[model samples]
Every structure is written in C-alpha cells, then in structure tokens.
Target chain A: MASIYIDNWHIVLAALAIFITGALSLLMQLGLAKSIFIAATRMIVQLALVTLVLAWVFEQDSVWVVLMLLLLMGGFATYEIRARQKLAFTGLWSLGLGGIPMVGVGIMVLTFTLTTVIGPEPWYAPRYAIPLFGMLLGNSLTAVALALDQITRGAKQRQGEVNDRLALGMSRTEAMLPIVRDAMATGLLPIINSMAAAGVVSIPGMMTGQILAGADPANAVRYQIMITFAIAGTTGITLLLATWLAVMRLTDNRHRLRLDRLRSQKYPA
Target chain B: MLIIKNLTILPINVERLELKGGVTALAAPSGAGKSRLFAAIADLVVNEGEVSLDDVNRNDIAATEWRKRVRYVSAEPSWWGNTAQDHLSDDEKTRQMAVRFGLTTELFERPIEQLSTGERQRFGLLRALVDEPRVLLLDEPTAALDQDTSLKIEAELVRLAGEGRIIFIISHSEAQIERIATRVVNIIGGKLREGKK
Candidate 1:
C-alpha cells in the first residue's frame, strides 16, 4: 500500500486551518495570534528553503558535499549552543568549549551509527546520513547548551560554598563535582522524560514521520528505537564533555574560581 | 612569622608588617577593610606586593597549598551539605575539638539547615582546624557566640597560638583583644598602625 502524498494544495489547506485557528485566537483576545502567524510564516519559509537545498545536495551524492553539509549543521548547532548560554567564557574559549565537544561527539556517534549499524549501499548517502546527523547534532546541542548554562550559573551562585570547600583543601575539580553532576542531570532530563513516555504517552516525531512517509510500522519502530538510543548516548557524552570543558575554563590551574571570565551578571536567584 | 611587604590591597596598603607566632588582633571600625586584608593574606582576593610565611614566599607555593597552610574562616561561614558531620573530617582530633566547642555528637548528625548562626560559626572554626593549618586567618570567629562561649573560644585560640601557630583575628571588642591577643594592630585609612596593648 502506498502512502498519500501531500501536494501544494494540501499544504495550502493546512495553512487555511492555521488561519482559522489564528482568527479564533484573535477573537478571544489571546494576544498570541500575531506570534502564531509570524511563527507559522517563518516555519513555512525556512522549511521550503531547506527542501530546495536538500534536494540539490541529494542530487550531487558526493562524499565531500555530504561532509560539508554535516559540518555546516554542526557549526550552526555550536553557534546556537553558545548563544543560549547565560554565563560564557570570553572570546574563542566560549566557542571552543561547547563547540569542540559537541562536534566531536556528533561526528563519533554519527560515524558509528552510519558505518556499523545501518551500512547503506553508499555509506555517505545524503538521504540517510544528513537526517541522522541532524537528529544527533540537534539533540546533543540542546543538551550541551543546557549543561553548560546550568554548571556556569551553578558555579556563580555557589561561589562562596565553592571557596569554602577550596579553603578546606579540596581541589577545584573536587569543589565543583556536585555542580557538574547537577548540570548533567539537568541536561539529560528532557531525553529521560521522552524515553520514559516514548510509546505510551506519545509517539515520537521520528517514528510518526517515518510511518507517515509509507514505512512499515515495525520498521519505523525499530528505526525509532535505534535513533533514540543513539540520541541518548550522544547527549550523555556531549553533556559530560561540555560540562568538564566549561568548568575547566571557569577555574584556573591554581584552583581559583575565575568567575571574571563570565560576561554576564545575571546570577541564579 | 607572617610577613607582608608593601602589600597594596586596593584601598588598603601595608608598608611592612611582621605577624609573629601568636594572636595578632586586627581591630578596625566597620567598612575599614579588615576582612579584605585577611582575604588578601589568605590569597582569597588578588593583591599586589608580597606575603610570606616564615621565609617561603606565597608566589613560591601553589595557591591550594598556600590556602591549606594559611586557612581563612569567613565571618558568615558557608556550609554545603545537609549534615555538619559531612563537612568535618573523621578523626579523633576533630571529635575532641567538636566536643570542646560544646558541639555534641548529636548536633553533628542534625541537618546543617537547622544550625543557628552561632552553631554554624563554631562548626566553621572546627572545620578550619581540621587541616591543622599553621596560620589561621579568622574573621570575627566569635561574633555570634554568647559571652561564656566567646571566652571559651578565645581561650582555645590563645592556647593554639601559644603552641607557635600564627593567628590573625578580626575582633571588634577591645576587652576580648586584651584577653587573647599578644599584640594588636589598628586599621585606619587603609593602613595598619600599632594599637594599645
């Protein structure tokens, strides 16, 4: 059985549904009607642009092209992670602390999955590689960003406690261990919640998308399981790496809390 | 001796000072940078010039190592864990010190959040003594204690100093200073001067 395709007119019909929802929101004075319309328009334009770029890349089927695209995705993920942080290291340290660890984890996990687990006809096939890379990069990016932000803010808020520990003869790493652990827990919460509620509470986006695209239910479920595991593994490793690197940057070799490196003053309450 | 040479601790300057092995009470009015000077000596804050313990320069030793030898207990001590026992070392000396400070073993088991400011201050002093530091930089260690408890703590600190351990204490009470301090210095206009004995 073939799955029904969504043509232009169908997409237009979906827009009409969104417009009706927006109109109702406006009538009810929800105050979110304008935001909804703006967000919807942005999504349409961005996705349309992505579709065109993806089509071009798919046609090339070159390894270099695929690799470049993957790098671009990782770069943007790194940028977004840095941008989201409340307290960040100065200059290139900010970029490299989160960026290097995330990209390193992304490349390692994606390579392992594509080469060993899936093993498509062309190992560098954009169709499989790009989407998989995107999923891993995007999820890990959020995790790393959250972890960095939490740990940085945690260190700032607990500066006195940390200094007291240091005065008690604890090393910098020893003093910050609890903060790092807390940050890791904070970073992995979303993934943990999703994993707990995967099938029963809600169908995951990947699984639902695959099933909608004519894939067999069983096959789609299996793929979803693999991707979920991959995401969990990637996020854990990336968050740990990011937190460690960030903490190292925040402290000096002499075990002093160098909160001076942070650019922002909005500390945790 | 704890020596300070031309130490410029931003808004406070010490041309030269030698703190021998005894309680050298630092007395100054409020906002006189007494704690700031102590922080400088402990390397908790940045300062220009030199600080040396005996003949070894602070720069010659690692910061962590320096802090271990020259421990600073703040006015309002910070505790991290739920139990006071968690912050203390498991040793006979620590237990004896706790007992001497009127901190019952039962108090150690109780949550730190339940501890009053006075109890926390006692625990803070105990925590600092755990490392057996050669130089103790205490900022108002007995500020929250009652008269009897303050005198007891002062006697213990004087005893520690008599054992050749250097101690710098920031105290507001001249009577307490007279009771415990071997020498006294007054901080005025960001500088140190000899005070009444």
Candidate 2:
C-alpha cells in the first residue's frame, strides 16, 4: 500500500470543520467567533509558512541551516517565556533565567535522543532534528515559563516571610527555598498530567499524527513512548533549573529580597 | 553602641545618630520615612552610609549576619506556614519569650490563619528574637496590643535593653514613647532629628 497524500482541495474540504465551529460560536452569541476565526486563520498561515520554510531547509540539508533554524526557534521561545510573566525580571535576566534552562535541557535531551535512540543518518538531519527539537523546545518552554512566572510571583507575594527569614540570619538559598519549591511544583504539574493522560485519556498528538501519516502502529507507539520520556525529562529538568535561576535573580549575596528587580506592573498583557 | 553616619535612603536622611544599649523611639507621621530609617539601619533597604555596631562596619559582615544581629520587625508580619508553631523558633528562648509575651503553648498548635493581628505581631517579635539579636528595629511593635499588653511589652523592651540590646522602635503614641523610650528621635522634614525626651 502507498502512503496517501492530501491535495489542496482536500485541505479546503477539511476547512469546513472550522467554519462549522465558527458558525456554532456565532449562533450561541458566545463572542468567540471572531477570535476563533482569527486563530484558525493564523494557524493555517503559520503552518503553511513553516511548510515552505521546512521544505527549503530540508532541501538545503546543511547542518548550518538546521542550526540557524534551531537558534531562531530558541530565540522565539525565550521571548515567549519572558512575555508570559506578570512579574518577570527586568532586564537580560528576564530572558536568561528561563532561556538558560530551556536551551540546556533541549540540547541535552534532544541530542541524547537523536544520537543514541533515533540515530538517523547525518545525525543532524533536518528531518528528525527539527521536529524532535521543536517538540522538546515547545514542551520544556511551557515548563520553564510556568516556573519562572510562579517563582517571581511567589517571591513578591511572600516578600515579608522571606525577608523575616533572612532577618533571622538565613542564607539567600534558605530564604528562597519555599517559593522555589512551590514554583517547581506548579511548573511540573502540566507535564505530569499530560504524561498520565497520554494513552488513557487521549492518544497524544504526535502519535496520532504519525499513525495518520501511515507509519506502522507499533513503530509510532515506540516513537510516542520515546518522545514522552524525552518531553517529561526535559520539562522536569528545565523547570528545576529555571526556578533555580529565578531564585538567584530574586535575591543576591546580600540576602536582601530584591523586589526592585521585578518589572512592577509593566506586563504587556 | 550603634552609630550611623551620613546615611541617606530616599526621603529619609540622617547626618549622624548614635544609639546606645536602650530602646530609642522613632516617632513621625505616617509615611514620614520612619520605617524607611529602621529598614536602612537593618540593611534591608538600599541606602548609602557607614553604619557600625561597636566599630564593626555593616559592610564588614555578611548581609544575613548583619540582619541577624540587627533584626528588623515589620508591623504586619507574614506567616507562610499553616501553624503558628511552624513560624515559632524551636528553642528554649523562643518558648520562654512566647510565654512571657502571654502566648500559650496551645496557641502554637493552632493554625496561623486563626491568629489575630495582635497575636501575629507578638509572634513576629519572638521570631526575630529567636537568636537574641544585638539590635532590634521594631515598626509599631505594639500597635495592636491592648493597654494591658502594651504595658507588658513595654516592660519587656526595657528588659531587653537592660540586657545590652540596642532597640529602635517606631511608634505614633507619644505616651507609649514617654513610658518606654530611653531616648527619642523623630523624622521631621524627611530627616531623622534628635528630639528631647
């Protein structure tokens, strides 16, 4: 049997589902039709653009091109991490604190997966490297963002308690440990729930996509399992490291609670 | 003695102030930078000055060490733990001080949310005194207490001063200051000025 292909008209035929949803939203007067349509349009455009770009990148088949794309993805992710926070750190720290962990975990886990597990020829093949790293980056990006946001907010809300501890001669680490722990818990909860729900509550997106694309079910399941482990490991380590970096940014060697480092109410949205 | 020279922290400036081993009452209107002065001396706020306790410069010691030795207690204390006992220092001195401040052993086991504002204030003081700090900076330390408890706390502050701990206290009650303070300082026109007791 040959792998089936989706023609452009076939894709437009699928567009009916989105139109139905938009119609239902409008019928209900839910005020969601506009946003739904906008989002749907954005997704279509973005994915189409990525398809074109990925086609070119794959044709080029150079490590330099792949690495540049990876850098671009990483840069966008770092900006997103900073943007999501209501009380993110003020300067380069807003990027560095979360970005460091994200980059670190993505490089380590993806490299391990490709080199040891997947082992596709050329190792850095855009085919595998791009998608794998995208999956890892997207997954860990949420974790790092959650941890950074939670830690900063926790520090601000718990300023009195932490300062009291510091006043009692507790080191900066001790003063910040509780908030850090709480943030890490908040960050890890999503990945934990996703992993728990992967097979039971839902067939995860990657596995479903692969199966729909005509890969053997057995092989797709293996890929899903490996990716799940990679995502989980990446998320946990990224959260821990991001919270650690946030705690450092929150306090200094003087053990003073540096609420000044926070951006006050300057959140964009 | 605690000595501050040429200290400037925002709206509050102190050219020179020397505090002996006694309770010095800091009095001013609301937002007069009275609390800011206390925070600066405790090294909790950013300030520019030379502060030394017995010739040991604030810069010479670690920030934690300085804060431990010179503790600052805020008026509205915070509780992160579920129970009051969790915030209380687990030590003989804290236990003894808790009882002396009229806190029952039962109060320790109760959830911190159940604590009254007055009760939390007392706990805040006890928390700072857990390790017997050399200097205590208190912001309205007894603002919530009744006349009876206020007098009792005043007596305790005097006694702590007798033990050679320099205490800086912020208060709005002139009567309370007259009753407890060894020396009085007022923040006037954004500057700490020595006032006649």
- What DockQ does candidate 1 score? 0.65
TM-score of each: 0.95, 0.95
Model 1, range A1-269, lDDT digits (tens) per residue? 66797799998887898888899999999988999989998998999999998999999989999989988888888778778888877888878888888888888898899899899868888999999989998888888888888999999999888888887767888889989999999999989999999999999999998888889999999999999999999999888888888778888786778888888723331
lDDT: worst 10-residue window of model 2 chain B: B86-95
lDDT per residue for candidate 2 within A21-136, as digits (tens), equals 88998899888999988998899899999999999999998989998999899999999888889997888988888887798789788889989999998888999999988999
Pairs of colliding residues, candidate 1: none
Query: In candidate 1, which residue ranges exceed 4 Å CA deviation?
Result: A265-269
Docking quality class, candidate 2: medium
The clash numbers for all candidates, in the given order, read 0, 0
**In order, what lDDT does every prediction score?**
0.87, 0.86
lDDT of candidate 1?
0.87
Candidate 2 lDDT by residue in tens digits, B1-197: 89999999878888999988888988788977777778888887678999999889999999988987888888888777898888766778778888788888888888888988888788877777767889999999899999887887888889889999999999889999899888998888877778989
Go through the candidates in order and give each one's DockQ: 0.65, 0.66
Interface DockQ of candidate 2: 0.66
